[model samples]
Target: MVSHERENHFVISTRSYQADVCGKHLITHKPAIHECYGKGCDRMFPTISGMFIHLESGTCPSKITLKDVNAVVAMYTHHNSIIHSDYNKSLAAMLNREDPPDGFPFHCPGFTPGSLCGKRFELFSGLLQHCESRACNHTFGQDDGGLLSFLHKVLYSESALFKLGRLKANVYSRIELVFPEVLRDGEQEHLEALLILLQMLFRKLLDIIENVQSRLKAAISKHINYQILGLSLGHPSNLDAITGRRGDLSALAGEYASITGNEGRIAGPERMNTSEVFVWNIDTGECQLLHLFLEETTAVFEILSLETQPQ
Candidate 1:
């Protein structure tokens, strides 16, 4: 039998079959949310078994055995239901058009599942959850190389942090492909800042991967238990090389490679077939006027260019 009096943490009280002594504040099946539903009112309740009672019975006893309680805690924390919930809510809001366009992505455009804006929110939610778990919020928006710097370093190490980099690239490519047009000055700047932070995080992950890979090489050569080491020595470079050969693969390394500039020339040169032409005749007769207009325009442009040519 195990019991805790801490208000912040849950306690499990055990009684064999049905024998127990009562203590003050030690209420059984206390008629609160958990009493009524076997779930905590606050949302910090952890454990599948703890929740299992909530699922099976309308109410769970307040006092649970220490063994059952620990089992619940291990499963719940390992599964990370709380963090998943937070991330899901963020993504759902973006996907469902519930979030107002605020600092970044200034344009909602509409709810397209495969759109850049949607993808950004999705990846952002994931990254945000990871940051929260690591308690990385304190450094956000701080000047003099604080949180922002930390995030930047994390993003830039993408080559090493295989998973983070892969996820970021996926999101980045989706954005670049969908929103390949000029953005407002403010929006553009905001996107740049966001990319910087993402890049920093990615870079850190890469460094970790590099270290892991070095260890992996040594482990394999020396017949070490790589699995026991629990390191993330990654094959990101090899993976990248292989994936790069695929026809569907795009150059996702470049930031905003598809974000348009002032002149509106596409950021990446897209090969287009120009061999096909369509001609229409207004009166089923030779329409020489349109051709003449084109010729005159071309000649005038040429004359202007030649006269204004420098040296």
Candidate 2:
């Protein structure tokens, strides 16, 4: 799945159609063209247009020094892989919470014998026995063990492959390890460009998370109202884990409780019927709509900024 190509310094991954250039798979987010070409181009070009044409056409300005395209390819591929691992981990976390597994294996076959071996074996045998007794129904459950196994593999497999030394050396070797010589030629600018891009990416991620949190909060509020029969029943609670850690929603919830008092309670709990279920469904739909909107927006911004370094 992971391969090195002589034509391009990048370690190509042909594992799947969905396999990402670095680690990310979204077709809309191919590696930034500028970042890719700039890697081997001169530091100073009067205009981006000049830079673009020179790189696109494989032409070089007489005054500007250019490294081999192999170096550029290496940097692009290496950085992409690092970013992919990070974003993929985050995505996995979100998906796992929304769709938890139905069952888990007691013993992890992938775990090697070592300090945790005894514990692992016990746990493993327990799950296996449990599975056999249940006719392997656990395997078919939503919480199947396969997901856990895969997670383990991705998190630990090939620990040496992604190391800084390996990635950096491989990337540098694209031009016969000329990165050091480039450094002597003023690598500071290149380093700065990389930092700017990474900073921009970090900020964008924060925006995405904040947007999701805000929408999630609203959804929670609506759910509470539908379940309790009215938002008038209680002040908004900062039930959000992020808000709670900062003491943000707690005081507000208290204030709301005081204002609403007993008036917020549904007049008849026993009288509530299946008709209210329809209302809950509607609220759920609205909540999901908000989340979807935020997600799309985040993806769009990320894609747009792919090639632009932070200003």
Candidate 3:
């Protein structure tokens, strides 16, 4: 069960034994010393408030800024909503249609009740050509709908320092399973530290997604002509009905095919099976392991720098 406390801005999930604060989760039952749920900074705090303050202070080696945490919280709030889930399901259903049109299915906010420019297509490639030839300003926006919208907002917003943090989190989460094991005691400690950092960043990204959703919902309710509202309101097929534009997934599939020279196969957003994608690629796995080691080293340097600084 989920219990929300508006006064303290907390959400408690009994099944998960987790308490959500500002979009991030903390394991409860021990108030005096709180351990950060962030991947790398599992450090204990004297109090719950102290842990929150530490996260906000950006003192953690992961370099997770206050803005980063806030963005994550916003993202988490919207993504967990029932509306977003329903929208995704509807879009997926449309894509699975047996007899799709000739040009790509596109959603055009510019198309109101009567507009000649709002035309549908079956193939996304055709839609792209048409948009370019006609100088139309249409863009793709429905890979993960709400999540993508949140990312766009974060990208264009003023808080630019942690712009790549979310992307990094995505990459790490996907590639983490293939991480190499270490035999030496020193190497094992380093590996553990690196994994923790990755986890911390991943959690922060989730929170940001939630926070963005909440903001988007509020904005949609208040403003009639918000650009995001158009994107948010229209289902995937709505664009196809008005304008022949392809969703982000189809476009990505096409791009992947072109790059990989794979015929008739498209890459979906689903997580790749580790055995199929990485187990045989020893070199690639090693590279990821090395990358994590480098990150750990950088974090150590930052911590040392902070320690030696004159107060």
For candidate 3, write residues 1-311 as lDDT tens digits: 24444334564544443212312332233355546533346688644335545655667554544444433333334432212232343343332222232233433222323554554433323333333332344443435544434432342221222223323333333334343342333444443444445334333333333344454345443212222211112122322333212223334334333432353221223442212221112223332333333343243323323323455
Worst 10 residues of 3 by lDDT: 272-281
TM-score of every model?
0.19, 0.19, 0.22
> lDDT of candidate 1 vs native?
0.28
Query: Across residues 203-303, which tens digit of lDDT does each residue of candidate 1 receive?
Result: 43343333444533453332212221112233444444332222111222232123322222222223421122111222222222322322322322222
Backbone clash tally for model 3? 39
Q: Identify the leading candidate in terms of TM-score.
A: 3
Better of 1 and 2 by lDDT: 1
> Which segments of model 1 are wrong by more than 4 Å?
1-184, 209-311
How does model 3 fare in lDDT? 0.36
Q: Which ranges of candidate 2 are over 4 A from the true structure? A: 1-182, 204-206, 216-311
lDDT of 2 by residue, 89-206 (tens): 3333322223211232123222222332211222222433333232222331223233323222221111111121121221112111112232323334433343333223333233
Displacement of the residue 32 alpha carbon in candidate 3, Å: 58
Q: Point out the higher-scoring one by TM-score: 1 or 3.
A: 3
Please report the candidate that would top lDDT against the real structure: 3
Which residue pairs come into collision in candidate 2?
Answer: 101-142, 101-143, 102-142, 102-143, 103-143, 106-123, 106-124, 107-124, 233-264
